[model samples]
Target chain A: MTTMMLVPGFDRVVELVPGERAVAIRNIPATLPVFATHFARFPVLPGVLLLESMADLAKAALGDGHWRLRTVRGVRFRHFVGPGDQVEIRVEVTGRTDQTAQVRATARVEERVVATARGLALVAAEQPWEGTQ
Target chain B: MRFHLIDRIESWTPREQITARKVTSVAEDCWRPTPAGPVLSFGLALEALCQSATWLMMLSTDYRLRAALLAVDEACAPRDVVPGDVLRTHAVVESMSDEAAVLAGLVTVGGETVLEASGILCSLMDAERLDDPADTALMGRQLLGKGAPR
Candidate 1:
């Protein structure tokens, strides 16, 4: 995939309890072009990319549907993720409704908490995007 | 692709606030396939706002300090941004210190609020660590259209 496809789909799902919790892992490759421009010399995964990974994992746990991120609250970047770092992303569904779902997410590297969000709200799209069917 | 998110600086009020523009393009790498359609990633949209806020902080410090996003207290994107949409972001400094600053950002499309964020904390650092002074100065000037013709 090109550098634009930033999430770099999860390599493995350790556990997934639909409507409850999900755990997944992704290994950051040293070659991602994003590392070059994010900081030409000092390379680290962008914090936004970590949030996107959490969002993607939330979608996986929520099942087949168009889940669009609506809001994020209390997100903190505690540590930097660098090349060769394996990130484990965890998401827990805190609440849900017909129109939206609320989740809390965290990312860790080698048992050290790297990033977290207290709440992420996702809205369900009524229809799938064209050509995705 | 270069990660420069803000396309241009529309206005600036020193340390108070800054308004910037971003015109999405289909050629940009940020587009991702979604169930509804390919849409601009919300993270990128947020990044744009952060970049804009960074600019404000940088200018406020006379380019002597660089800002790094540290935390987001709250953020919301109510509308999906598609390719070709022009986004206007206004970032207001809510608080600042020698080492950090908290800013609020709002993004709109055609006068409609699409995204809003508050309590964005950015840590200020020495500018030389992230970029050369001369280059950063040039970028600031270009973004403000300092030398461009009408």
Candidate 2:
């Protein structure tokens, strides 16, 4: 693949339940260079990255290249996930159509729900921006 | 880790509103390149919006508290953003409280809307302890167009 940029995709796809759902894990490194620049004294995983991880897991659950992330909604961060923390993502397909899929995803560190989000993924071939951008 | 997504602030009004820009360049930090042209990742675009919201929170609170992105109620980017395109974002305060605030905004290239979002940002603790003074001062100078911060 194109080496899933920024925050380096998920560490591994721990489990995949076909089109229904997937679970993945990523261990945040304390030495991540961004942490040094994000804040000199204190650092926390960027909230957007938390959402991105969820999206990646959702995509994994979908399987194949037929789908790609399109929109993210109702995502909320309940706690700060920092360096050395292990983020476990669980994504479930809430609904689907001929060309699109809706997923509800959550990220937890240990037993605490750190973040949650709902998103839509469009089939690669049918995505609005396919080849006409 | 320290990639500053928003290039600069074009305009500002303390807590009420603000406008910023991100200049896409070939040397930009990205995870991968594609044949589809300058595709600003959805995550990066979302972070840009969140940065603007954070700015509003900073100004509105008189720099007393640092704001963290809490939630995105809704968001969409209808088109792909390519190189040489300047992203102009305008964010406004929808509502506010001591603990958190609602922000609404859009990202446009030229005159076409590329992305739109509404979200919430929260002030969790004292800004003094959470923010780097130099970075904070730099942002202030940029918003006021005082060159490259002191």
Which has the greatest TM-score? Answer: 1
Alpha carbon lDDT of each predicted model: 0.85, 0.73
Give the per-residue lDDT digits (tens) of candidate 1, residues B1-150.
577889899999988999999998888888888766678777888988999999998898899987888899999998878888899999999989889999999988888777899999999888778777787888888899895333
Off by over 4 Å in 1: A1-8, A128-133, B147-150
Instruction: Give the DockQ of candidate 1.
Output: 0.46
Model 1 residue B133 CA deviation (Å) reads 2.5
Instruction: For residues B1-150, write the lDDT of model 2, one tens digit per residue.
Output: 355677778888876888988877666665333344446666777777777777667766777766677888887877666666778888888777777778888888887887888775555456777667667877767765686832
lDDT of 2 by residue, A20-132 (tens): 88877898999887787566667888887777677766766766554556777888889988889999988898887667788899899998999988665544534344422
Candidate 2: where are CA atoms >4 Å away?
A1-8, A121-133, B31-38, B148-150
On the 0 to 100 scale, the lDDT of residue A113 in model 1 is: 99
Instruction: Give chain B TM-scores in order.
Output: 0.95, 0.85
Worst 10-residue lDDT window, candidate 1 chain A: A1-10
Q: Which ten residues in a row have the lowest lDDT in candidate 1 chain B?
A: B141-150
TM-score of 2: 0.88
